[model samples]
Target: MHQFISVTFSLLVITGLRVSVQAGETRPERSISRHYISELTVTNGGRWGSWGHKEMCPTGTYAAGFSLKVDSAPYAQTNDITALNGIRLHCIDNYRRSLNQYHEYSTVRSEVGSWGRWTDIKWCPSGFLRGFALLVEKPQNTGDNKAANNIAFVCSGGAVLIGSGTNWGEYGAWSKTCEGKGICGIKTRIEEPQGSGDDTALNDVTMFCCS
Candidate 1:
């Protein structure tokens, strides 16, 4: 299940610039608000699972941060194939601000999996991390695996290095980022090993360079 929240704020400005009290008489400022939604799908057993649905920010808000959890490496000590466990998003509400993130996920589910906690927000120095598209794959049914293998974040420059997984699925082509003017940031979440015979997955992403 996904959860969302909306926040509203006001910024005082004059003549396309922020004015202090001494600059001039106080003028009424425009008020704006935005809603943020978090969406996810049930987990799968192996690498042949469906792609998780995508979660977009509200009409007036753009993606500012993102987070994902996966199953991989030592955590999957049984060497069972893994898939996406969780997904999250952070958005900023700016009527004229640019879009920051774009994403897609598998639509199939083979088995049920667990989800980890959300990660902290990440931001760029001068702009938001621009998102391009998503890549998804499902590996063959073998080695304790039969679900969506891995998903990749295709950025403005290139694909996000999310690490290894089953290598038998589909790849979503790249797309253009959203329209707007602002910097970008990267949000990531990883689930470590808890106890014996636990699975592990890395959910790290790269940031967009501010120019």
Candidate 2:
């Protein structure tokens, strides 16, 4: 019986180690060759939540499109409102390529809130994303507060792309344009759900430009 128990324990140890290695492999390593050229930020982001991990596009790629995660209006109005939940960056290898011509690409995002559904991706007609503006609602002392509502991105091709997010807050000034090729990474500030208090999911965001 002791021999059998010892074998079982050994197997468990080996299995645990294998699982750990596999989990580590799932997270891609950041390449040293890919460096951020500038950080884009706005002033009107909500004053809630902690900043999430910064996620970046793979080497040789830049962000050319984006999507939003937004809570349904009916659900938000009835329950604790958290309008903009998350933002995702869709990357492409060639910024000059047309929207429909790209066949292979990758998507990346930082931390996302627990609420809302991801919207369809909005792509730039040409070039990469260079600047951004955010819409945010002011604090409500006693009413429902939805911090970040929508986002707009300015492409290097001079096209402006807007997201399908809730219309709650006013848009802030556009962030400084990318000093390099385009925006390549994203980091967000999100507030977790409060048990019985006001909850504002996405508060702020920062964009990283890469050369």
Question: How much lDDT does each candidate structure score?
Answer: 0.32, 0.77
Query: In model 1, what is the error at residue 98, expressed in angstroms?
Result: 10
**Residue pairs whose backbone atoms clash in candidate 2:** 136-169, 137-169
For candidate 1, write residues 1-211 as lDDT tens digits: 0110010001111101111222222222212222222222223223222323222343443433344445554454354444555443334444322332222211111122463332233322223335432334433334432234444332233223231233444444333443343222222233343445334332222222222
Where model 2 places Cα greater than 4 Å from the true spot, the runs are: 1-33, 75-77, 95-100
Q: Ten residues in a row with the worst lDDT in model 1?
A: 1-10
Residue-wise lDDT of candidate 2 within 1-211, one digit each (tens)?
2453343335432221011111212233333345788899999999999999888889888888788889866655476778899998777777434544444556788888888887776777778889998989999988888899988888887667777788776788889999888999999999998878888999999999998
Model 1: how far residue 80 lies from native, Å: 2.6
> Which lDDT value does model 1 have at 19?
18
The true-versus-predicted C-alpha distance at residue 161 of model 1, in Å, is 8.0
Per-prediction TM-score: 0.39, 0.82
